[model samples]
Target: MSEQRTVPETETETDTETPEVVAPEVVAPEAADAAAAGLPAPPGGSGRSRRVLAAVARWTAAVLVFGGVGAGTAAGITAMERTEVPGLATESDGRWEYPRLSLPALPQGSPRPFTDGNEGEIHHADLRALLLPAPAGAAVDPKANGGWTTRDAFLSAYGKEDRPPLARALDDSTLRHIAVRAWTMPDGTRSSVHLLRFGSVGYAEEFKDALIASEGGGVVPDILPEGAAGAKMETYGDDIDVPDTRPYIYQEPKPYGPEQIRWAYIQAGDTLAVVRQSRKGEAAHVPFQQTVTLQNQLLG
Candidate 1:
């Protein structure tokens, strides 16, 4: 397992209301006796003081009762599991259970990629530490186990015929590092994430533009993933709102063979990430989207 830096999960605060306290009617003994005897009670006597004291006692008791109920409700909510709470429980949505994620520490005196004063927008952290971790129960690929990889290893995902030109482009693009992580889930879904860091944001954007060109009324990558004859741009049903990142998602068109492939190219600062997921029959949309969005977030 690769060493990771993790941040605390955000805490959610729940608001609980105290039930209203309604004081019961309190009558002085002298007043009740006088009313029963059809005679008025003496004014300005001890009855007024007794009534005031009795009312104060009743109010105090009501306050204590309601306060205890509110405290108990809060405690019960805190003790219960998140899934046990009504309206707060999240049902299974086919999303993978990934490990907690946090940005890696940068070298002392180095600014973050997207922070002010870093005009080039270069990532100062270790590339391997930035790679997304494999989801729970995934079988990780040793060759691409969240570590540095050769350019050829990254190019191997594309068809052989396109490798030569892509290699030349990478050389000219000032590619700095390539960090990859690949895994397969129990459901037979294979996922690979590649982060290619360039010398600057300009070079990264240029290489990304060169890799993807317009084709047949849509944009498609010049070098398609291995086993994918053709792919088309796909718009995600849900919006991915990572800051300072742009994702170009593509899906293998219909009439695919035994398996289907879905991939995305995320351009963020000096890093361009390739996230791919394939499965027999059909590639699940939820997991692919989830993977791409998360990778983009990490890069951002």
Candidate 2:
């Protein structure tokens, strides 16, 4: 608990009607008796004195009841010296005036009210409902008359006769699954996500086109023959510098990740991904040739 400081200490002296002691001449005891019996004050004191004292006591009691008059007659401050914060020469309006603080009021129609930064972080979601970020810049979908079912139709959209080897695709029912697989950086600061699409050739081509478009690149048919896993690993690895990563766990907390990468590679299936790196993390590659061997599985 905080301790309270005492208000300024003041020394006050006062004249309390000191009764005058009179030398009573040798008067008859009978006369003094008659005066005392007839009045509240005896012969030596006047009845007025008793009445005045009583009045003073009542007045003092009333003023002190709440708070006494400050630094004045009623204050009972009879002193030889000074006081703190100068006595008011004029009647105090009795209202305490505080310093005026200048600040800017908020905009008229602005939605959110005044809030601390930490409080703002909490309420940001609600405020964002009124003001949202621009929509994601996604690629415009290509024009197609109806659902594409044939290998040639969808393949044509990616590219016609001039399409890279990526244009050709083979469907596989051996392991049909759509999954999200990710590769993490060594320091665990980043992850590259792939939506692994493993199925027939038609679907795989579409997925592949989408993936390449996202990467802002087209497949290289001349360098790596069509549908060849080993050729792709070498070609893509060289193009992408796959040699520069540390050891990365294919799966997180192990619910079937490493094997999935193997399956994705061997199935000739396509994986759609957007790569993001952790600003703060760690990777490596290869039994050199053996590492190339593993990455080649995707070419299947």
Candidate 3:
């Protein structure tokens, strides 16, 4: 698998600007009866205090949901203490495991709609995981105004040429519902891949449009994601370009897995590349060469 980049893969990795302080959280006052009843607080707060209250409220709700005695919202906490993830329970040494993605990469723009073995193996239903710290250069832009991701950065990572590869190969007619799972590394590095039912570029375009709008704060996250009420996202490039279907496209934020995972769409190769980064621990970053090699083997 030879990943001969028509474009020279940069020797340096992207680093992050220091994050701006999130406004201090403010917890709206709860009614005394509600407090006494121990009903969960309505989660609207300004800064850090709001965060603390929200956490407490979630624990209380979890307890109630899990039905723990002396338990209020804390049931979730207790359950989590006793519970174990199916695979995460095993704490092997720092080894990287590529988890199969749950979705297929929309590649209408690529020479190959799916991936070829020589260029890079298509990572549909697979993911790469590691315990390593984020690569030295990855960091979230503090001034991105709490943006989801930056466009210049994404282009730097995914590039315009890559976008065409996907556009060229994917079958717009086959697309059904397209879903995306994205993750932001604590160090500010981010990654994501769009999932779709083959040939359904409509969903893909709709998603891209939604992302462009949301990234600019022209739209809000809660308006679309009935599931996610408050989190916000940001974008980095020119508005998503999907013509013939809709003149405009904007992306709505999506949720995948648990924990604060930051995700976004970046055209990596013949397929959409999905990258996940954790906020607290080091994100496992494969050397650019390794990533290219893997992609070429999978896609070539």
Candidate 4:
């Protein structure tokens, strides 16, 4: 074998460079803390924070809903206890005395307050019960009969002209209430009555002046129609001898001598009573008698 190798002179091959193996480097605790402080939170932690914020928002909404419900309940209770007027009832002579009023009978139905009944057919809050010891019939003229709460309605009912001036003259604010009734009698006689309440006697007097001016061209000396035969107006006040009284009466003669139309106004305390009657072609004392009867009732 030694003699064969020396003769052939064969060579062995070897690498000049080789790669080195290295393990992965571990992260330092200080580097991890620095990243947490300067950078945004991880996805998992961000999701958990969102869940907590949603829970707080839901809790706040529930609190507001309960608070609103409580406030509404209290307001509803207060509204139910309100009264129309203060000190509206009183006692006298071992009996309760209260404001009581009535309306005259009509051809079809009785006159009732615009505000009436517990549920009130008209203005519910404006309604009040009249503590009357007994029911009384309203004083009325058979010719004109109806009821309304406002002057506009009154003018419309009678088909009067020049409504604006008259409406202003009879201002609704000046009167507490008004009731009207009218009808044509079986014998062709026409009549009407108005029951008005004023804040005071002085106010009633002022209203009376305006009323006459509106209906009969100005209150002074009375205006007469062009062809009137001889219109006469008779007023009776202290002359009647009733206790604490001032009354107004006027008789307007028609163009024809036989026809008679009369108007009367009376005051009892804060109330003003009025009547208008037209006798077609005859004379009767019924209108005056009716006036006297009403005057007596008011005084009583």
- Cα lDDT tens digits, model 2, 111-221, are 222233332111111211211111122121233111123344323323234443533332422223322222332233222222233333345445444333322243432
Per-candidate RMSD, Å: 8.6, 27.1, 26.6, 37.0
Tens digits of per-residue lDDT for model 4, 132-230: 111123333333334534555444532234455446656742667776656554455555555666665566656666545543454333322222214
Lowest summed lDDT across 10 adjacent residues in model 2 is found at: 126-135
Candidate 4 lDDT trough over 10 residues, lowest sum: 1-10
What TM-score would each prediction reach against the true structure? Answer: 0.71, 0.20, 0.24, 0.41
The parts of candidate 4 lying over 4 Å away from their true place are: 1-149, 153-163, 212-231, 235-241, 257-259
Weakest lDDT window of 10 consecutive positions for candidate 1: 1-10
* Better structure of 2 and 3 per lDDT: 3
Q: How accurate is candidate 2 locally (lDDT)?
A: 0.29
Query: After superposing candidate 1, which stretches have Cα over 4 Å from the reference?
Result: 1-82, 85-90, 214-221
Q: Highest TM-score, which number?
A: 1
How big is the positional error of residue 8 in model 4, measured in Å on the Cα after superposition? Answer: 99
Candidate with top lDDT is 1
lDDT per residue for candidate 1 within 1-300, as digits (tens), equals 111222223446668666667776767677788889999974635767778877897889898998889788899989997766777766566777788888899999999889999998999999888888998889999988998999998988888877887888889889999999999999999999999999999989878877777521212345578887588887764466577878888899899999999988888899999999999999998778778877777888
TM-score of 4: 0.41
Judge candidate 3 against the unseen true structure and give its global Cα lDDT, from 0 to 1: 0.34
| Runs off by more than 4 Å, candidate 3 | 1-111, 114-194, 198-203, 214-262, 267-274, 287-300
Output the better candidate (2/4) by TM-score.
4
Clashes per candidate, residues 3 or more apart or on different chains:
0, 15, 87, 12
